[model samples]
Target: MNFLVVIPARAASTRLPGKPLLDLGGLPMVVRTARQAARSQARRVLVATDDPTIQQTVQAHHIECMLTRPDHATGTDRLAEVTRRLRLPDGDIVVNVQGDEPLIEPTLIDAVAQLLARHTEAAMATCAAPIADAEALFNPNVVKVVCGAGARALYFSRAPIPWARDALADGRKCLASGLPAWHHIGLYAYRAGFLRQFPGLPAGQLEQFESLEQLRALEQGHTILVHTVKHPPTPGIDTAEDLERVRKILAQAVTAPPG
Candidate 1:
């Protein structure tokens, strides 16, 4: 399945300003993310940005970049504009890879795209991994997903879902038997047609409350296929601390001896 990986990079980050231009190892963070996506099976990789500086930086690396309007409310909105500007075919697959995820796994990208291709009835696809600890299960920053039979996401929330009613009431820290908690990974695969239509969909109440754009699709009765990744996702840069952690991790990997 041929697909285009669009990395929506905005220069204005509330926590870390000029985040896309920040240095990651030797390359700019946005460039590093684009390079990582390039290793995927995507037919093309493009960075959609609203800042001239970001566009120039991406161009300096000889990577394709598109300048989009700065007013887009969300990354999905930015991607919709890209689909129109480039006039991608309706059936073409477009994967939304976050600009901050420089360590994103290429195979996971391929897997999500393939999952969408296999589920011809679904309009979008994403991935999730099993939550290993109680702390993450209760962490609001960690989005959790509840899936129905055949890997269809029933709901996504910041709260611990599929709540272990009896167990929790009993003051138990464990989850109910057979109910596995999974954390949602912020990656998505969409058909170009759905992506173009996304902006027009009414903002969903659930989406507004959860601050999750994907809920708009769910609220509109669209199906989202969820696939489980073989390996856990590497951390994405979100704050100054996250950036430093990833930098040290990457640096260590580079200096480590060949085993």
Candidate 2:
């Protein structure tokens, strides 16, 4: 299955300006993300950004980069422009890897891609992991995904779903139940044709309420296959604190060296 990994990057991050260009150890954050994407089973990897600095940084690393409109409301919209400009085939798989996740697992990328390939009926595919922390489960910033039988996403939301009514009566019981609470992973694989048509679809009410683009796809009746990843989802750099966390992770990874 042919796949293209597109990383959407923007310079005007409200929490951290020029975030895509921020240094991650010795390399630019976007370049580090592209490097991880390169490890995936993708046929090609491209960084889509509206900032010239990001484009230059990616090109300096000899990675493919596309200049897109800065006003894109969502990463999917930026990816649409990339697919259009690249003229990818309708059946080709395009994975949207967030640029801020410098530590994104390549195996998860391969898994999502393969899931999309196997489930041709699904217009898109994504990943999720079990949320072990009760706080994270309830935090609106941590999106949750409920999957139906056969791993199809039933819904995506910022609120805790499948709320265990009785468990909430005792906080300790909720954590001890061992019931899996899935946390949404930002990675996504989409058919090139569907990606091209994404921006034209009317934004769904649920999507607006949750502020999750994936919800829009669900509301439009598009099937999204969800692949479960065993590892914890990589922390995406959303602010200075997140950047520091990623730096520590990378530092440990470097010092620990594979056994």
Candidate 3:
């Protein structure tokens, strides 16, 4: 299956202005993200942004860059614009790699792409990992995904889902035995044609309430296939603290000798 990776990068981040260009070790954050995507099996990786600075930076690294409208309401909208502008084939797969995730694993990208290829009925595919850390499961910032049989996403929420309603009263486990609670990974893969139509869909109430774009697709009755990955969720760079944490992780990885 033909696969393309589109990264949505906006310079006007309220929390961290010029976030895509922010230094991540020796490279800009967006550049780091592009490098990770390049490692994947994607046939092409393009950075979609309205900022000239981001375009220049990405182009300087010899990465493909598409200048999109600045008024895009969401990253998904930006990606839709890229798909239309490029005239990508209807059957092609486009992976939406968040520009902030510099440490995104290439294997996870491959997994989501494979899931999309295997499931013809699924319009989109994403990944999730078991929430081993109790603290992370409760973190509102860590989006959780509940998946049903055949890898269909049941729902996504910031609140702990499959809540053990009777944990206190009946002392019974909320989730069925052997069922794992999953933490949603931001990475997404979309069928090119489906992605083109995404912008026209009405935004759903749950999407607005949770501020999760994926929910819009779910509410629209689009099936999203969710794949489980064994790897721990890598932290994305969203704020100064997140940047520092990523830097530390990268530094340690660099210093460690190859096995």
Candidate 4:
């Protein structure tokens, strides 16, 4: 299925300033992300950003970039402006790839888009992976998603969902059984029509409390299909440490002997 990819990049990241422009193996972080997105089956890929420098940098690399309003409250809002500018059809699938994920897998991007294409009842689609350890399950930074029957997403939050009542009350450091805990991946596949209406939707109480944008759709009675992957992709850059880790991984990749 053909789809459009929009990478939302902001110059002012709270944890890491000028994050999209930061270097990753000699290329800007946003540029690296766009390269990965280009590898996907997406018919077109565009970088939507608020900074002139970032737009110039992306264009310098021969990548498409759109300079959007800097006052966007969220990346999704920035993407809405892009849909309006492009005039994407209501049925067109638009995958929202986070600008920070330079290591994002192209295959996974295709998978999410394909998943959304098959689910007509859903307004949006996202990915999730099994939570491996108690530490990650407990960490609020790792967003979790609970999916009901038919892979319909019931909720998304920073809290440990599908809470193991017995395990937690027993003071055991173990993950829940029967129903596996899942880590919500930031990647998303949105219908162009839904994306355009996103900014106008009133912020949901659950979304504001947990700082998750997906909750707003749930609150508005929209169905979100959750696609589960067995293994999670490499973590995206969120802080200085994450950036350093990705650099080392790229360095190792460059030097390692090809099998």
Q: lDDT of all predictions, in order shown?
A: 0.93, 0.88, 0.88, 0.92
How do the residues 1-259 of candidate 1 rate in per-residue lDDT, one tens digit apiece? Answer: 5999999999898999999999989999999999999999999999999999999999999999999999999999999999999999888889999999999999999999999988778899999998877778878999999999989999999998879888778566765566689899999999999999999999989999999889999999999999996557997999999999999988998999999
lDDT, candidate 2, at 233: 69
Reference-based TM-score of each model: 0.97, 0.94, 0.93, 0.97
- Look at candidate 1 and give me any clashing residue pairs: none
* Candidate 3 structure quality by residue, lDDT tens digits, 1-259: 4699999999988888899998888999999999999999988999999999889989999999999999998899999999898898877899999999999988789889989998888899998888876566678898999999999998999987757455424643344444467989888999999999999999999999998889989999999999887866677888889989999988898899999
Evaluated against the true structure, the overall lDDT of model 2 is 0.88
Error of 1 at 23 (Å): 0.6
- By TM-score, how accurate is candidate 2? 0.94
Clashes of 3: 0
Show model 2 residue runs off by greater than 4 Å: 169-173, 176-178
How would you encode candidate 2's per-residue C-alpha lDDT over 1-259 as one tens digit per residue?
Answer: 5788999998887899889989888999999999988998888999999988889889999999989998898889999998898898889999999999888888899999999999889999999988887888888998899989999999988978768877876554344366668998888999999999999999988888888888878889999999997767667899899999999888888899689
